[model samples]
Target: MLWIPIDRSLDIPLIRQVYQQIRERILNGDLQSEEKLPSTRELAFELKVSRNVILEAYDQLIAEGFLVTRRGSGTFVAKGTFLEKRVVPNHALNWRENKTDAANIIDFRSGLPALDLFPRKTWAKLSHAIWNDTSHSMFGYDLPEGRPELRQALARYLLKTRGVACHPEQIVITSGATQALTLVSRLLLSPNDTVIMEDPITNDIQTIFKTTGATIFPIPVDEYGIKTALLPENKKPKLIFITPSHQFPLGGTLPIQRRIQLIQYSRKTNCYLVEDDYDSEFRYEGPPVSSLQGLEPECVLYVGSFSKILSPALRIGYLVLPLQLIEESRRLKWFSDLHTPSVEQLILARFIDEGYLERHITRMKKVYKKRRDYLMHCIKTTFSNEVQVFGYSTGLHLIVEVTNFHFSKEKLKQIEQCGVKVYQVEEHTIEKDKHQNQLILGYGHLNQEEIKEGIARLHVALYK
Candidate 1:
């Protein structure tokens, strides 16, 4: 039996202080279930406090249903209550990747930036300027939607960079695109609503849809991205989400022809299409792909993030909604964490105003272009005529198809034991046997030296 002591020297009431500690210990599993707690008299004696304080604390916990009195059973721990365990995170492994494990050997996980190459000097200056010059509003809950300057800056930047025609009034800031998805899911979806997502999309999207209770329907994607023809006609969806600019994992551009068709699909079905222009700013080849949002401003919800282009730590993301939904979206944003942090929003607004973001993104595009080409070259030279890779012309990743090899969880475990890590395309699928023979390789964050070394190690892993 363990008892917590409350110090009498503290200004905080002994009952409150004692209650908080015991509550946290139980919730965090430090106090095991069915473990008998100390009697109120014993706890008061050890702490040198009035027995009333200990009694009060225990009574509060019991009132809150965190503890239960079992009559003669001596207050046994409550069984099958909500507080004990929550949020079981997934740890599934995909075998088609077969890249070298990160702990032992380098791995090419997608959507990561070569953070070592980020511009720290410029950011330090911006951070200093924002703190020194910003008003008191910068310290408080600014606006749930976003800071006026940051929203306007992002509005202008999106137009200039990605051809997204948006106004500050229509842009609602989010913590990141993931949080954007979380809030958007709640804002847009009702129970049992259908959601259209890319086949073999990021696994996190699958988790998001599941959590939201949205019945996700996989839309087939090709080299040019989501096939508008493959969209389900019988099951009308509430929302359709896609990475049209640079398709995730597969790297297709969802060309203008398909973009127009997708918008038409949304119009016909009376649904909204959520376009995630996640990494379009970092395209290595051709002119930047035109965003689907630019096609039909009224029907498409545009989402953009700084994680890939600027830095993930910034955690700044924005959603451009059509004016019709702006009021509804704003009301929801007011309740969800109020708003994003003001310091970053202020600093970033200044950074965009000063053209620092433009210059940095321009420089990074060229650097990433070199790295992407080098990877393609190595694969072409090494594989010779053996493997076929798709969507390497843009974005942070490309898929390599293996017709000869079979990917299984047991094989993934074998590769893991060998100290290699890779993501199989199948890991992202809701429908099985889709993308079973494909591997999504991420080289966006790796430099030339790291890329060559990692690919070489991957070859050795599979062959050996």
Candidate 2:
């Protein structure tokens, strides 16, 4: 092990500092894969730090994928992870140099939880109780289909809350909705099968769709969700994916009549509808929009996640599948990590069983409703008639159409620097320049203070 300097005066602990250094080294290729690392005691003594500090650092490294420990064989650097650190002279970071700088600025990004307001105390109590009850059985490998109790609880939640029809047997748990989409794309889609998607949705999903080698057809979206009128008649696509429950970014709920039409089309076309119910819980105008999965279960693959409502880190989500697709999805899930963690599922089971989740959703609904109202009020008070916000009734975000102002990328960068952030509608489009005057503002995570101040700064950026 190399000697690492310990900074006693820094607020960060020596263990964390050492961990970061080693991780950076391993990621950079200073340390090769499967190479033996120095023992904790030896490294501690050599670096003149306590042995416990070294052990703690190693523990964290192991928890992440930085290092692996073998019983009686000592720890070694992780393989296939040296890219994070190695520098190529001419290479430049292309993803986003502004990620760091952007993070430092106040954010208005969508699909985020209001972490400051979640009921941690109540969740802790349920978690502790679940641990006491199932710590023994949870130590073994779990069912690939996920924890039975959580599935059962989710079944009840769907019936009462979302009007979805399904039993626990048809429900499969995965890491999150992203994983759900990945496996669905793999299982249902053949190499050249066609996928019909909303033209202006999150680019993150595009990665998964493209990797499947599937032919993607981008259908146009309007204020009433995906325009059924614009759906391609010639392609006969294999599957159609939509965010019907308060369409992402644009925030329009697919109306019930349109949902029925989509369902009818799915049945007639023999195609599956991947309904991503991402943020339907926080609608400020009224009760949550009814899911398309309710219209037709066989044609609709309903997906939901607790990321926005509870926390993203939970990494727990459910998919309601038709019986025809259930076995294939289970097999895909088995190959994809076998199953999700049982302890968290067990805790969530108890959480829902005892009505904790319902309570949490009710509480969050009020919190987000208030935030949504404040967002509307802020737009009305600050920008007034200058900016027109779309789909303001439901979901976490609203689409602001800047009337007569040039909403250029350079202007957006300036607005980002001015301490407010938003999604460029143009980026979501397959073709550019269509949504030049539009911006998607997410207000779920921020409180009254951040929302007000962020919008005020945004106004300064806009008017200037």
Candidate 3:
């Protein structure tokens, strides 16, 4: 007699359980070819399940060619039904065991906004209104270029704020700046193509471009941004990636002279400049810096996202591409995920149109400014002349260069064990050892108390 186990405690249907067990046995070669199965009535009687359950299971197996029956004979396992099972390594178990808990540590990582300050009430109100009045067509797939409503609103806002000049037709909505860079790499790069980028850029950006199999020509940046004079004259790169308004990790605004040089170089070489204008709106100094895109819209592919200004969770960013690349970009975007979520786009469109986004940024600017000031004050009091702060005029994070000190891997681990976490500037540098003493400390998400305690702990970790 062929026996199959049944348990009443399981939520699965009796027919499914029976079907799965028999299929597993057949696939594992436990039941050989042409092996006879017990009659449905006998199996149902033995397993204490309904006859109909056994009949359904057998019928399904027969339909799937796992079982066959003769005119007057009972069911038999089909030939060639067995398959060898392969073992998959449990990599996630090791990763989970080694993961660090963030709750206990005062983390000062960059690019994180204050989640508590997000305009939740306004967003909820707009979301409710949008869903209530949404058109039937919105339930279907949207254009790959994104909703024109949001694009139009962004075009106007970018023009007024960042001096970016473009119509909604040039804008292609993306999941975030990461996706924008990925798409740009796909559009402009081929294997072994040359590209130029800052030496100490965000590691994620470096990884994105490297995945395209392009050769990255690293240009060193200073207090003013990328050294445009260092750009290779003989090399004709396909793309030049930059963070002009505020350089990542180092936080230097590219000067107008360098900006013009970049434009001239791109035009001469017929290459595209990808301008990432991230977190330029929160400049604490004079007026927000005008984008490199506005200088030469034809040569620049402008990338902007709400990830830094508002919240990263929104996953809404856009690329203001040159007119020539717009169609191909739309096609590539369609091939990638088939468009960003439509409902959020509609809600954000309303949010921007009603001046809520501006108001929120205005409010957060003051809050972030205060936090930035407090963090600076705490660092000054704790470290005194031992550290010099750089790039505090704009953006959410600033660089602190520790005098005559290098943040080695062991030192960083020691700092983390002391209940504080900080990022090393060397982590973002392509040619390391130059920025070994500098640390990128972000203050946008931290409160004054946490900032004070974190600095105090860091001081002890460094000096002790």
Candidate 4:
């Protein structure tokens, strides 16, 4: 006999409850394919439910294809109803444990900020205030772009800090830089559309663009940044993606001359440019550069995120879109997620409005610069004239080019066996051979002592 338990107190109707449970059983493979279910009369008697209720439940299941009924026989479980279960291998679990829980391993992975220094108390206070104090309407479905308060706060903050000229209406809050890039790719590109990107770009960035069915044109980057002169003349691309402030892995800042050329190229070719100013806030040595969007707001779609400065878990980033693309992007955002969470948006807005974000950035800049200096000092002391470091003095990471050293998988495994975790820059490169001897060292998450010790361990791992 089928165990059919019906609760009269449940908000869900009795018919729906029965239908859902049976469907779950079928999908979970508890009910074998083509197995006959108990007759309605028997089920109704077993549960003490009316014949009408049992009939209704069985009818729903039959209608939805969870069960099939033959006129002469009984209802049976549908074939092909069971879902495939996900299985995790033991070795994969072990790898994850070692990567996450192993002690004494110092990681120099890029794109991570100093999570230890985030102002938790202030953030909690703001979050509490927003939750308890804000209106009930805030908890409900709001605008697709974002909460108005957060968008307004972002407009003011961007203008004051990065010189990005934009109104609150032009801002669209996103989950993070990843979503921002995704929105742009979906809206702008069609299948087979051509896009120009830095040669050794981040894997996620490359994947997102590729998923749009776009063909990528890889441009070689140097110590000065993307070689703008080498962009194919007369070959008009649909879009150009760049990390101008600090190039990923390579750490080169695009020169003003090249930036101007890019803007002019965009204007002449009528192609859009995506300026991902991911870590422009952490410039240690030079004056902070303004976003390219400020130069030609109509031609460039600027992307900014708090992941590097605040916490990546915040899932808060914004896109300052061109006037023409505003409505379409917002519509796409609506279709994708409706909106970012209202509570988080409210908390971030309060954080920015109350000046907590600025104060935090100011304090962290000094700390990060100190850490950067220590890492640079340690590398110079250990390697002497044998190594050259690129993408230095700014952002969270640097690229070290060691003479005659190739970070093959076996070599990386050997380094890992020594309890140090450093990444090869070649991992991000499209043409891996070009950056075979270089490694990307992100120092933002590590302290001064960890930086020194990690470098020493790496040296020992290589030469010992």
Candidate 5:
């Protein structure tokens, strides 16, 4: 039987869901070429749906060439519909799924928020209200720059929270920072154009630039963020991608002087600065760091996402672009996916407007701070002076450098075998053999007890 689970609670229609699932199975080879599909009557009986609904779904699929029917024969998979495997790049090998004992493992993976801390009840209320009352006109395509309400809500929110000066017209909602970077790469970069990026940067950013055929010049990042003094004096790249607020994998916030120098460098080179303020909501020490875009709105393209603060599953992010790049970015985004879903956008906008977002951030910050403190305590008690932590007091994760331990492949595998998972900063490094002794421990998603136990297991794995 071709089983397609239909959720009655979804806003999508039952017939559309059935059609989409069958089409997906055909495309993915789950339904092989020439495979017979069950009759509409049998499928209707099996799924407990109306026979007319099954007929409608099948009619659409057949009309779309995903299915075929003959007088004497039943429906079958289309002949040319078998998808061939395409070659993926070597860098994508990191995406291979790890088969682990899920019941006992402790994960310290980076880029995850504490999902347990999200305000699910409020989100559900907003979601239900939005779905129930939204205009039927919104069921169709929306503007590529996103819904006006969301952009406006984000404009006021950014001005108050991040000190970003932007009109709603300049904000383009993206799937997340990933798509925002993709849009920038597509719009600003040409083949062989030069780009300057942090050496130990987010792997996805590096891959995005590489995929766009940009010539990447790697700059070493220190404790104070990307070394502004080391920026090329003679040549200039089209863009400089940076994480100024609590740098990724290593926690260095660019100081005011460096930020000024970077803006100056961008101005001199006639280039743009891509400032990714990914996890700025959980600042634990010192005053909140202001965004570089606020310093010089004309020179910096600021990107932010809710994935770090609220929930990654929401797939909501925005780019505060300079006036010059606005049109092209929107055109590219339109060609990419038209726009993010309108219902979710309205829900998030409401979330911001109703004060739930702020309250959630304030509550989660304290929770994460406690987890951070407990993790630091455990690391101190376990490794003592043998370990040095970086990127502390901010962000969901911190870097732990164990002086005597080298995270070679074998060592990492051994640690994994012991049911503890911690990521190495060296994996994100562009220059080989740097930061090999450092590991990134993400505490946002784990409780204090898990943090202590995970570190203890890691300690045994490394020491034993």
Candidate 6:
């Protein structure tokens, strides 16, 4: 007789209990391969349960290849079903616990927008309207190139705002800018191919290209962006990654002279330039600079996302491809999740077409500029002549260069221990020890009070 226990107290179904125990026994090798079991009637009689419950459990086991029955014979365990359990480490649990403990830290992490200001009511209304009026075809598999409505809207908006010259067919909507970069990497790179990138670029971007097994050639940037004069003359790179409108971390708008030089270099080497226009929408100085793609559309691939302007939760980003790369890009995008969520794309299209996106940006720009100005004032007042600020004219974040301070790992941990978290510019540098005195401070997500308190905490951490 088989030994099976039952508990009527558990909220779990009796069938599930029976099924799990039998499955566990089989996998644990307690039940030998091809061993026969008591008939359903016999087991039901033994367990004092309904015959139908036993039958259902047996049926489930049979369906899962755990058990089989011969004609005119009893059921038997399937062969090769036993598996040795392996221990998994608790690192993930530990990480989650640590993350929970960081809730009180005043984090100055960059690349985040004012999430509290997201138009939730407007978005909800759009979502409801979309769900009500959407055609049946929209719920099914969509074109990998994304909805025509969204692409057309993007074309008009990008032309008017960023001076990017591209048709709707050339835009490929992606999950986010990260995916867009991945697609670009896959499209242009092969193992051992060379890529030229900014020295102090975002670490995530560097990691993405490195995953392609390509070597990244780092060109150092000054206050005016990449030293185009220092671009490698010996090697022909596959692609050149840059953030021209507002260079990340360092925040230099690539000067026109260097922009032309970069275009000339790409033309000479027949390499494409990947322009990441991340947070140019919130420029605090003059009007936003035109994208590098506008100068030479065929030689540049422009990547943009709504993460900085709206919310990263949207996960809506796009790549403006050259004419020659559109077909293959569409194929690659098709293979990558078979297009982004169709309903969200439709909603965003309506958002852009109705002028909601522009109005939101205009509103947020003022809010961010105020935060930026207040942060600058706080830093100057607190640090006096001890620190210098860089890249304050544009973007949601700026860099503060402290006189003779190196943000080593131990010092960073100490700062965090003081209820403050700040990012070091050295963490993003390709060549180490170059940007040790600099730190990136982001103000987009924090209100004025949080900003002031964060600056205060940072001051205590840095000086104390």
Q: Per-residue CA lDDT of candidate 1, range 1-464, in tens? A: 46566677899898999889888887777776776778887878888888998889889988887778877766544544335566655644433664544457566688888799888999899899878887876687678899999999988888987889888999999999988887678878987999999886888977886787789998878888888888888978999989888888788888778888888889899999998888888776677877778888998888888998878999999999999989888888888888899898888898899999989988988888888889888877766766788887777787877667766887756655555456788888767787777777888787787777666656665667
User: What TM-score does model 6 achieve against the real structure?
Assistant: 0.93
Candidate that beats the other on TM-score, 2 or 5, i.e. the better one: 5
Q: Between candidates 4 and 5, which one is better according to lDDT?
A: 5
For model 3, the local distance difference test gives: 0.92
Pairs with steric clashes in candidate 4? 251-391
Per-model TM-score versus the true fold: 0.78, 0.80, 0.92, 0.82, 0.81, 0.93
Give the per-residue lDDT of model 2 (tens digit) for 316-430.
9888899998998999999999999988898888888888888888888888878888888998899989989887777677888888876787888888878777777877876
Q: Which one is best on TM-score? A: 6
Write down the lDDT that model 1 would get: 0.81
Of 1 and 3, the candidate ranking higher by TM-score:
3
lDDT score of residue 391 within candidate 2: 78
Question: Residue-wise lDDT of candidate 3 within 1-464, one digit each (tens)?
Answer: 77889888899988999999999999999998999999999998999889999999999999999999998988999998999887867884565453456787999988899999888999999999988999989999999989999999999999999999999999999999989999999999999999899989998899999999999899999998999999998999999999989999788989888999999999899999999888999999887999999989998999999998889999999999999999999999999989999999999999999999999888988988999999999989888899999888888999999999989999999999888999999998888789999999998999988999999989999999
- Model 4 ranges with Cα > 4 A deviation: 1-101
For residues 140-207, could you state the per-residue lDDT of candidate 4 as single tens digits? 89899999999999999999998898999999999999999999999899999999999888878989
lDDT of 2 at 66: 89
- Against the reference, the lDDT scores of all candidates come to 0.81, 0.85, 0.92, 0.89, 0.91, 0.92
Model 2: which ten-residue window has the lowest total lDDT?
91-100
Model 6, residue 400: distance off in Å is 1.7
Off by over 4 Å in 5: 1-99
* lDDT (10s digit) by residue, model 5, range 264-372: 9999999999999999889998656889999999989999999999989999999999999999999999999999998999999999988888889889889989999
lDDT of 6 by residue, 1-464 (tens): 98789999999888888899999999999998989999999999999899898999999999999999998988999998999987778885565346425778888888899998999999899989999998888889999988999999999999999999999999999998999999999999999999999989999999999999999999999888999999989989999999988888899999999999999999999999999999998888888999999999999999999999899999999999999999999999998899899999999999999999999999999999999999999999988999999898888999999998889999988888888789999899999999999999998998888888888888898998
Q: Is candidate 2 or candidate 6 better by TM-score?
A: 6
